[model samples]
Target: MRTVPVAEAKAHFSELLKAVEAGEEIVITRRGRAVARLCSQRPLTAAEVLAPLWHEPLDIEAPEDRAPEPVAEWDD
Candidate 1:
């Protein structure tokens, strides 16, 4: 982890971004107080968000004889 003043952070913004991409944590301080943090953006892996709802394959075709009418008819 690294801490830098606001001025230094502004001066070396590109370098700091590269460092963050390499898994480094950075803290931006203002008047001796920590105000902000910079960290790498972590992408969601396939397993994290793409878990299958069902494992077995099943039929998913629309019925040919399905009625097109609504259950309740409303008066216009």
Candidate 2:
């Protein structure tokens, strides 16, 4: 973790982002008081990304009840 004044933080914003990307936490202070923090976000896994989609039911219409059409087999 690192602490920097607001003015310095603004001046070296890009460098601070680089540090944050490298998993460093930064605290920004204004007039000697802590104001903001910078940190990298953890990447979501495949299951975590799909969790929301699983929560809601999809609004898809069911196919009509009838005999299914046969798919033609293709010859190589």
The candidate scoring highest on lDDT is 2
Model 2 regions lying over 4 Å from their true place: 43-76
For each candidate in the order shown, give its overall lDDT on alpha carbons.
0.84, 0.86
TM-score list, all predictions? 0.55, 0.55
lDDT by residue (6-70, candidate 2, tens digit) is 99999999999999887677999999999999987976467655665686765789988998889
lDDT of 1: 0.84
Clashing pairs in 2: none
Superposed by TM-score, candidate 1 places the C-alpha of residue 70 at a distance from the truth, in angstroms, of 60
